[model samples]
Every structure is written in structure tokens, then in C-alpha cells.
Target: MIKFESENVQKFAEACVDANSIDELLAGFNHLEADATDCKTWGITPAEWMDAIKAATAEKIRIWASENECPELLKAIAIWKNCPLEEVEIGGEGDIAAGNKWLDDDGLITFYRWNAATYGEAK
Candidate 1:
């Protein structure tokens, strides 16, 4: 196990909550690891780090499900829970895409969609 500051751990937790991608979470964790302490008492293993990230993601999903209208967030919850997006319980009569867009007027759906539009699809 590697050691780090308790403050690093707290910052890691906060970053995980806001991380919308695996890359972002790992980047934050790596940055924190650079300043770790020299004793086991403050060190955390990679597995523990991954577990913290998962917990943060789950907590975010729970909060989003309870208080958000964006279907993308709902879909994130559904995917996190391993359930069908259709069964995630959004209060709307429209299809998933429509409901998503209804709430935000621009639900990008996935990273692929964002990249596609941002960079243009290949011919």
C-alpha cells in the first residue's frame, strides 16, 4: 500500500463524485498519489482507490435519480444498476431520447455522440 495525505483522500472522493469518465477519476487519483505519505497508516491500495471511486459513482447516481429530470442522468443510473434504461422510472410520456431532450433540449446520449458532433463523422 502507498501512503497519502488524508486531504488527498478527501479530494479524491470529491473528484470521483464529479467525474463523468474513468479517465478523469484516474487522473485525479494519480495526481494525489504523488504526494502520499511514507507510512501504511495513511496509505491506500489501488483496489481501495477503485472502490472509493465506485462508491462515489453510486452515490452520485442515487442523488441524481432522486432529484434530477435529465434522462441522461437516469440512464447513467440505470447503467450503473445494471437495469434497462426504460425501467429507470423517468416521469414522462416521451421516448428516452425525447424525454432526455425535453429536460435539457440537448442530451448528447454518450461520449461517442459528443465526439461525433464535435469532430464530425467520418465519410
Candidate 2:
């Protein structure tokens, strides 16, 4: 049976990936599974697995977003100020090139300016 109220659902899911039946799964951490492939012992279903995956992914996104308080654009600006990039022209005919660096281009940290086509990933 799935250890209900377990916060380490992702770890459990990972361990159970190769299990042919619930018997191979853990009751907790110490207890081994019985030889019998009892369906009742399997607490999680395919649907529940999907749900768990979705929840885990969403939670990761939330955590990542929270941790990345400094946006890419700001980081690029800081790079420009701290470590000056090599002679990469500030602008080309009022063109926007390096601005896209925050998302795609490698010029984000090194380049001084860009012919901004759009506001980059950072504000």
C-alpha cells in the first residue's frame, strides 16, 4: 500500500518504477514486500501517478520561480556594469540585437547593448 501522507511521493514513484507488482514496493522503509502480487497492496494507480507527476512538476516550477528573484535582464545589466564586455557596439542603426540575449543570445553578460527587437525575458 502506498504510504499515505508521505511527502516523498516523487522518491517513492521513482523507486517503484521497475516494480512489476506492489509486492516489490515498500511498506515504509524497513519492511519488505510479500511475494504475493496483491493489487490491494498497490496504493497508487496510473491516474494517481500522473497526478503526482503533475503536482511535482508544478511544485518545482513554483520553487524555481521563487528562487530566481533576479531576472535575466537585471543580471545582464549587472554583467555589463561589473565586467565590461569587449567592443560590441552599443547599437547598430537603432537596431536591437543583444537585447534578446537575456533569453536566447549569449551576449547577455558580455555585450554592452543590443538592438532590442523586444523587451527581453527580464523586465
Which candidate leads in lDDT?
1
lDDT of 2 by residue, 69-118 (tens): 34463454445545334312223121113233322122321231231223
lDDT of 1 by residue, 1-123 (tens): 112255655556565567555334435444545323322433555555654554454344334334545656555535544566776554333223322232221222232233335446310
- Alpha-carbon TM-score of each model against the true structure: 0.32, 0.28
After superposition, which runs of candidate 2 have C-alpha atoms over 4 Å from their true positions?
1-42, 73-123
Local accuracy by lDDT, each model: 0.43, 0.33
TM-score of 1: 0.32
TM-score of 2: 0.28
